[model samples]
Target: MTRLWNDPQEFVDEMVEGFVLANQGYVRRVRGGVTRSTASPEPEVSLVIGGGSGHYPAFAGLVGPGLAHGAAMGNLFASPSSTQVESVVRASDRGRGVLLSYGNYAGDVLNFTAAQDAVRADGIDCRTVLVTDDIFSAAPDSRATRRGIAGDLTVFKTAGAAAAAAYDLDDVERVAILTNDRTRSMGVAFTGCTLPGADEPLFSVPEGRMAIGLGIHGEPGIDETDIPSADGLAELFVEHLLADAEIPEGVDPATARVVPILNGLGSVKTEELFVVFRSLVKRLGERGVTLVDPQVGEFCTSFDMAGASLTLLWLDDELERLWTAPADTPAFRRGVVPTGAGVSASDAPSAAAAAAITDLDAEGQRDDAGADVPDSSAESRQTATRIAGLLRLVSDTVSENAAEWGRLDSVAGDGDHGIGMQRGATAALEAAESAERAGAGARTLLTRAAAAWADRAGGTSGALWGVILRSLASELSDETVPSAGDIVVGAVRGRDSVMSVGGAAVGDKTMIDALVPFTEALDAAVSGGASLADAWQDAADAAERGAESTTGLVARLGRAKTHGDRAAGSPDPGAVSFAALARAVANTLKNDTEEES
Candidate 1:
């Protein structure tokens, strides 16, 4: 369990701050995460790697000379935002290209791909190498679907070393790909991990049982069995990796030179790993495999998960050379490299990059946001005020039901949905209210709210809500108050935007389930000549029905997708929150319209 924190939402930020403060000799704080204290002197390839927090030495600890140039740290167990990645990239970019590497999680893929495109558009070359070494996540033929686990270390290390050795961007990328290909890991857990401020674990293993092939993000494993002895566990890991045929086709299993990583996920102390590693080495030697510099310690970890993983990196000549290269960071280190030999901090960021990093949240939220509000008619001002009221109601409703939402989400997902929604709604309310006080028009108010929601929430829900609000804002013109028809169009647009951005269909057991029905009902009612408030009420009711119907759904998307059966009979937290927000908006509309009348 997490022992200390101010706000759970701020945990990642505070963690990053403290990490930089402690490792000032190795890393410096950037907007996103951290960059090497001593930058590359020449425009050589830069290695940028990251994922969620909790995983210590695997990421930020690997940033330094002859290792990653920077890391983009996201919230705990969440992927960093594209903006965050771009900020880190720009902060660390030299004239040479950048190599982006991370565990192959869905959110990480989406955000990192977007960031890659953004940087390439800016004429800064960017390439990505996704680590997919967890063999049990998918069949051997479909290795692309496998999630990276402790194997993340090998790929990142190889790529960073290649970049440090002054390999071109293409070579750095190639090494990263090769490392991922040659690496495979399998993890087992005796218990599940708890997140900050959460009362329970993300998952649990029955007493005396063990979960096998678990993820580093506290995701439950795919297989289970009775707990095994240290020797038995080592044998289990070796058999799994060997049977998967992950070693290069030409490499013989009997004599392949490999770097074995015996990694403690978390709460599996160093002593336990050493005990396991002893058996692991003996088993490998008996199999006629030669081990080189086998690593034994925490690499990538889940927060306090009582588990460990074994990774085998079958090395080629180049890989073996890079694997042992001298490196230094707060956590990971090897042979020492010359100081002041790489890009220096004096290079810093371009003015544009600096601005993007500094104003990441604030710059995205504005419409005509400056204190200068164009003169608007009383009706427009009233509409803006109503938008503020809607967010206030949403904030209150979400705050009141936050715990229930968390409970429902905990049944299937990471259990942060409720608190995430509350944070976003509250932030949106404050931002919208401020916009209204600034005498902004309807569109400006909603746009401000949308940005604030996304900026504060910091998860899938946050990004989706931002898209929904932005879509709705697009419907309301700055000049006129929104009519029932306009509202209906906005709802439709919001629904479509959610689907487009979220990649979740109505039946995927996400917010889309409720959002689609709500929009349809709103459209139908408005077309039937219903008043705005009445139509909104109808939409809200439809949303509730849709949310309730989700109890029968098996999630096909997001975190719950892996535990579909376990999630049956529970409504998606996102869907339920959407329904609640719809009702709150409807209530606000009714009250405001009645007062005006």
Candidate 2:
């Protein structure tokens, strides 16, 4: 359904470039995403908000005075890598502390938390407030587990307003948490969204039917029913929202003041939203509820999804004030911006921020490029060349099997695993090739590949793969060729690193299922005096079995977990990809052994 694109792989980057070009007064391009182009005279707490790139106004469009200072844009429906998040944080930081906010997806949590820690280590005070407001994702008692939907606006707006008012880091975080606690949202879709270069939508409802409680990432809904009229849909929304269980604690629906946000997901027009809002307002008024600052339009979206979500933020005195505060972002504007809130375009300082960011990024790249290469033995240099070829094999295998991986992921997840793996592997291959041509040895080449995979791919798989390769690289030597024993130790380290970093166990229905078995089998074979190639074959077979076992298991972690048993009959795409990669490497090793014989 995404028709206009020069190259599917470059879609996000191109989209960001165009957004910056169009909104020069509001935002400027940074390494990761965009930051405010205009600087305030005094330092204030920076609110850095972001997630995947498809949710237009939810992120970059909200960067300006009285809103987010910057946004860390990720791939379509994927979380940004930690490197990307950190880059955005540094670019946005003033003397004041920083607050990071985003939807509470697993990948976002992992990446943002890592960035927070990284900045804190550099003496920058940083905090995180996750938006968990989609009522259908979790029960009232388990609200903290819910994923954020359109309610992201309520949290980000309140936090950004508090920061603009010169509130300290602690208060900004507090208000953000308070806003998230009061907000509740639900979404429905008449159809599904299709990713670029994909042949079909991620999931589809039957004709004349609608999917209820679907995620913004094109994930299938929890239930399907016949389409309802505008009034009926409004009633459905009001009934579910005003339910005693769904209402915020200590709030009386009959006497509450709420900010109602009627958000179009993507393809739905403003006219249709107004039609629904008309009935919705009447229903709320009849129940004695007072609505203030009702917003109706596209605030968050899934690319071309014919759906919408309703979000309600129960407002107290403080929250009401913050909610209605002035914000002059590209998409969201409220009241009149205070004078001196931002610098004028011709003020020289406006260009300084962009120039400073570009210089810092260039400096980092130069440091990496000019880092001294460690001396290597002749055997280790030859092994590095072979490793580069093996990386190319991985890239080819993942690219060839990407479609099947995407299909498997669509059963419950956002369906980007295949594309992510392909991007990471290709980037890793390119980095390895460049490092090899630079006369780098085994450890240095792998380190470069690891960083490239994480930086280019930007997701959960990308982060974990970077960890795996980095751990393996640590075990390799520039001075001598690595022995089978060293490889086994490295495999064990990679497994441990993945578990520690991803926080997934073997039965959690993640890539760990296959990775654990592969590492264990390789360790056993090597310990029993097997050759590296033969041991790798045994490990690959074990990984295949582990991946197959996931077909009967329910996901207990990550995005798929929200769908409960919907993923039970299909192998996790992550586990399947791990098995495939292991097998591909094994095949390459077998060929190498045959040629040597």
Candidate 3:
């Protein structure tokens, strides 16, 4: 449906009014709907950032605290007017100078350049920092001309912080340039957002597919692929970022840390955002990339659409400290600062430190504390190993099934569910294996593995999986022994988290149908004082039955919804898969415990 707006002009005006009103204390609307931070003054330098309006908390939301001094907000999915840019520059001008920073979009470039000239005529010193951080936006040789995405956060944050710290205009511009040099972003969209007064979406992609490198404002993407899991998506984005902004040749991938922004473009839930973040972090870790600081939320949006963008900012000492600095705004706020003895000079972990194998136990398992503990339990290790193996199997199965399922569902629905599920499963397996190999406790292994899986696997299913895993892990983390009762509790919490985040109840044709009963049965068995194996057996059996029951249940959410009555007679694949996984885990646990005894 088109947005309920009186007219395009009125819509833009009203939006600007609301934004300024909402942020009155920290920001003020200058000419052309641009917002400027009241805190910014005539310093050695001035910072200006702007872009289309749809991506909120972006061009404007960042105009406070240690961010942009001023922002030129454009019309919905359109660049701001040149006059607006000029007005913002005048408002932001300190006698010392101004730096115009904006994305590398044609409309933005034209307007911001004109605004720069206008400011120069006014006898104000002004410069520009164009952000071109999207690797897929253009060929490598043409990267300078590529459109900016979420990397704008880093560019502005660094520049704003430098300006706030009283850096000269040239120095501030240099900080912005340095941030861009170390930043890259990539995104994929499953659907497009509609402009405020438009009935149709800004862009379109076939159902069950994703448009990789799609511009935030409905610009055409590089290509469309069957939607991938959060982990797969993370891998895709990370690979591109790493390749485009090659980590220094001598740097250890693991010790190399960066800031990650898992951004939702409206319509995507917080749960999904977490899933993407988890995947991004895990993948980066495996590749020797450490996460120095992370901001996960809807920093930018494209109305109500299903999609996400990943932004990575490789930090030097200066940028990292600036990023870590305290800031407050309506949309974003830094938490309590660490009791630091001053910021560290080196952003990269030392080679000697990196060489040391920290966090491993005597059994060759990694611990959270990064210390090796001997005499770790063999039974726990075996259980972790089995779970890891099962996760791998699940990943392989999902991938194989996704291709087949995608083809089958292509007739009536987007076919990427199969692929999405498979990729998520694969990512989960990798995380599980890694945690287990690190000598994590059984509970820790399951919890971390689930988090890893959910993070990498992107869609609704990925979110669900993430919730389940996180709930389970949280419950199990504090337990020393983790009896069947503990497992039951963890499962119940997982089921609850899934329902809470997804808003789906049992019999909704979502994974909850299987997960709810599975956990309930496990709880009952545990409370009745059944053996761990017995409780697990009952839970697995209940899950299978629950999954089978979904065959007759009409789909309520997700791709199955489009199937209508046809979705009946086929068990929800998510439910079926959940049951299968539970059964495998139960069997493995039983066999392992018996062998140990």
Task: Give the winner by TM-score.
Answer: 2
TM-scores of all candidate predictions against the true structure:
0.93, 0.96, 0.55
Off by over 4 Å in 1: 341-346, 358-361, 364-378, 594-597
Candidate 2 vs 3: which has more lDDT: 2
Q: What lDDT is reached at residue 96 by model 1?
A: 83
Compose the digit string of candidate 3's lDDT tens values, residues 434-497. 6666676666677666644543343456556766776766665322555666677777887877
Best by lDDT: 2
Q: How many Å off is the CA of 552 in candidate 2?
A: 1.0
lDDT of each: 0.82, 0.88, 0.67
lDDT of 1 by residue, 516-566 (tens): 999898888889889988999999999999999999999888867766777
- The alpha-carbon RMSD values of the candidates against the true structure, listed in the order shown, are 2.6, 2.6, 22.5
lDDT of 3 at 338: 20
Question: For candidate 3, what is the TM-score?
Answer: 0.55
Model 2 lDDT tens row, 347-445: 322344456445435322413465456788778889899899989999999999998998898889998888888878887888888778778899888
